[model samples]
Target: MHLSGSPTRPPRSRMPRALRTLGNPLEWTDIQKTILIFFPPIPFTLFYLYRVNGLLADPTVEPYISRPALATTHSFLVGILSAFSGLFVLWFVLRRREGTHDLFVRAVIHSWFVLMGLGAYLVGPFSTPVLIGYQAGGMAVFLLFDVRRAAQGGLVGLLVIVGTTILERAGLLLYGPVFSSVVFAGERPPDVWVYLNLAFTVVLTAAVLAGTGLAMALARARQEEINELLATDVLTGLANRRGLEDMLEREITRAQRFDAPLAVVMLDLDHFKRVNDTHGHRAGDAVLQAVGEVVASHLREVDAAGRYGGEELLLVLPEAELSGARAAAERVCAAIRALVVEHDEHALRVTASAGCAALVPGQPRSGEQLVRAADAALYRAKERGRDRVEVETDPAP
Candidate 1:
């Protein structure tokens, strides 16, 4: 069965030691991207503010009206306000769990680009090339997302550029008097210089896109490795206890929503401590691994099998009634008993006891309650002598 949740909050105490040393990778990556999205404009805004202050301090440096310093000041303030406001909104949404991190990241990046593009347009053509380059670099950052999302961002950026260009051209045609006074006062650079600048921007964008793509691929690969380590039992290659908890929670919700049958089987190797005392710990590990494989082989595709701690495993069977769960538990017990693990040239055979519990209609129980019932039955199976399956007794009305 498939398990889904926010990657940011993976199960605790299940991650590999190495991964733990690095902290939550998803959260770290999210923070980094958020900073990249919101922090880059601060320096530029500060620089413009500094320049505006200088211009006001001494008008001889450049006439305020001619230099469009006031317009630059306004754009810088708007950018700072937009960045902070967006950051606060995103942080609030994340805290509320109302949206995905990636979704918020995309929104922030897109809005930043749109605002920057508008600012560039307002500042007129002399500054457009440099700002356009910055916009391209911002587009390259979309690589932090998946290929499809990156492509979507790229398309949106292209549309914004085209639309802004068209509007600028149209303004020149329809409102020449007003547009010329605002945007065309500065002496335009040579055509060669403009084209050269555009070419440099394109080349820089391509290089950044390639680098970002590589970095994203590496990050994704590392995340997959870490996820594997977190979810799997090192000894048995089965789902670990934390993974089982996650799966159980999801299955519980699904069953409750659909009013479907669900069962939990708690299995424990009998006389496991004795086995370890008789044989070495390695032999005990081998036996546990064999049992894990046997249990997995006996389960259906919709069933989940996991290691629920030392010498103990759990099975979650969705859409399985009491009888079906009993049968499955019995089968698992038989399979585990039949398992043979060869250690130190000795064929060691092991047996397991299992307890089965199923959800009953009209009786509401949480996933933990189901597991507790199964565990109680498991105790009974142990008391009844190992290598058997016991179903939890149903409560009377």
Candidate 2:
């Protein structure tokens, strides 16, 4: 029989594709999405081992006397169950579709529950101090794993402690053996209930702090991206004037400290306006893009390149001398001459003129002076009939 009133609607499996795109599904990377699935219940298995070791280490403990072999066998059974649950998690991560987000939510919740349950079972019968430490350790782990949304885990951890406290209280009121374990040691009964409450408070406080710190970190990352956009040029993806100045100031100090050479290359597209008039503005933009790409190819990982303004571009070459800077400029000129941009079914070629200047060691100069020296060399290249690299004879000292 059809479940819906309208049989023409067909089954939900045949629903429109548009309806499926309404909600976003959370996704994880390949390693996180695959390998973690098979290892979900690993913590619980280790907890079981710890519990067995605890009992074996001291048979006079309350847990050993209460049930002895039964508790040991129960822990081993939980370990076996965890192994199966791990297999299920692996299958869910790989094959589950259309509800992957919901499955992730459920999986994380289930993992949290198992950790809390294991922790409570392991430490609940122990002295107050040990139980408090155990719960604290669990809270720390949850914070490290998922600090952004840690409140949910914190609540689960609190519930586990509360459940343990209720059981201990009931045991003390009902059976004398529960009280004998704590009080039998001394006059002071170890204050198990107080310790549980303190642990709960500590976990809750840590979760709140973690959430606040995560939010601040995300905010700082966004701010850095915005600043980068403001300091960068949109066209050639190079640093604008502001970014160039910042780079110069930063590199100057390093050059002074290490006594290394630093050089600057100022380049301009020769007869740029003539090219714009002869071809078109679109062609001019293409020429600039091609030149930027060529120069970028020659730059090392530590160097910085940027569009200064209009047809001019700036290059900062650290640990380079005047001769080295001249060589780099020549390479840049050759690279630009080779740039061929496809435009209107024609391969358009362009050439660039370059000026090279090196910073004097142990001599300080303003950023403007350095730019002016490079700019003078650029003009010299233009005066020498363009399309050539010129090195400044007198650089700033």
Candidate 3:
């Protein structure tokens, strides 16, 4: 007999769908994301420029460890040039092109990190810790890669810091004629300084990453809300004309591809102007809203209804033939007749006239053509009598 085996461990839960789809920073639109990416470098570039200007104004100011101020000045100028070059390329060259924009953004970020690392080493030991910390934070914010790529980028940044420190020490030993030539030439900083620098780098990097992530997430959410608002009718809680047109186009494409039937119904409130004159505009609005609710409630899941304009509504029904469309229009007409709106303590009842048209196979039917046919039938229904449904006859060859 075999011995009993140990229990198997449970499988790990997968990441949430939203978190899994958190896109790369480079994938963001060039306008806002690119501007934000370049923000961190602005402060450092300004600081360097200020320092260089001050040193130039007062040439008698003592150099750090017998190193000339000109070397630091040159470093600052290089950083400013790099920052301007990146911005120019983004605005002028990349413009609105996403593919090249993404590549350019990533390249600029990597180059900025390299420039900052080199500047920190050249600036001397006294300022190395601060520069390295800032560089680490900036990299964490601007890299905007996925977890694996971000981790690799972070590792590269760490290597930059450590390698710069080592190279500075070597230069000191070699008596190189540069900024901080004498100070780091002999001895390295204390181990406590190194530990403190690492600690500061880690803390700042975490803060920048978290802050950037939160801001980007909020911006994305706001954009979605704005789009929804733009596509919605404020009064009827239905799709606006523009939104309706978009849905109609998509349904038309699907119907054409599948060789299925598609239908549209155009409805107009009967004697709507009389109601506005007898009661008031507010009462007319209430009637419109009531009509919207009735039409929406009567529609099937595959159908979409939207406000065509004042006193009018349109419906799109996919996979529906002419007879089916006429039945749907009759139901909507009956539903509107049953709706009662209360405005200023007045009970108002309204009726709608509808025209139905269906796609004819082997005939090229467009959204505009279908809508115009329905409108013609609607005009006929009104000419005969209101509160009825009329179906457009087949188009002649």
TM-scores for all candidates: the values are 0.54, 0.57, 0.54
- Candidate 2, residues 1-397, lDDT tens digits: the string is 0011111221122222442452111123322333332343354345545645654555455532345443644565475567557656665655545444534544554455555454445445354434544454444344334553345655675676567667767774222222224333545434443543465446545644654454355445446656777777766667888998999888977887888888899999877897688778877776676676677789888888889999899999999999998899898888778767775555777678889888897677666777788889989999999999888887755
Best first by lDDT, ranked: 1, 3, 2
> Which residue runs of candidate 1 sit more than 4 Å off their true CA positions?
1-191, 395-397
lDDT of 2 at 384: 91
Tell me, by TM-score, which candidate is best: 2
Residue 56, model 2: Cα distance from true site in angstroms: 10
lDDT of 3 at 100: 45
Q: Tell me the lDDT of candidate 3.
A: 0.68
What is the C-alpha lDDT profile of model 1 across 293-348, one tens digit per residue? 67888999999999998988999999999899999998888776766777777778
Angstrom error at residue 33, model 2: 6.5
**TM-score, candidate number 1:** 0.54
Model 3 poorest 10 in a row by lDDT: 1-10
- Residue 103, candidate 3: how far off, in angstroms? 37
Candidate 1, poorest ten consecutive residues by summed lDDT: 1-10
Model 3 lDDT tens row, 1-397: 1111112222222333454465434455644355555565565566556655654555443443233546555665666677666676656656654564556656555555555555554444346445555555565544454455345445665576678677657764322234342333457854433553465456556656676676566556556656666776767777789989999999989998889899999999999998999998877777776777778889999999989998889999999988999999999998878777776777788889999888888777778998999998899899989999999986521
Of candidates 3 and 2, the better by lDDT:
3
Clashing pairs for model 3 are 172-185
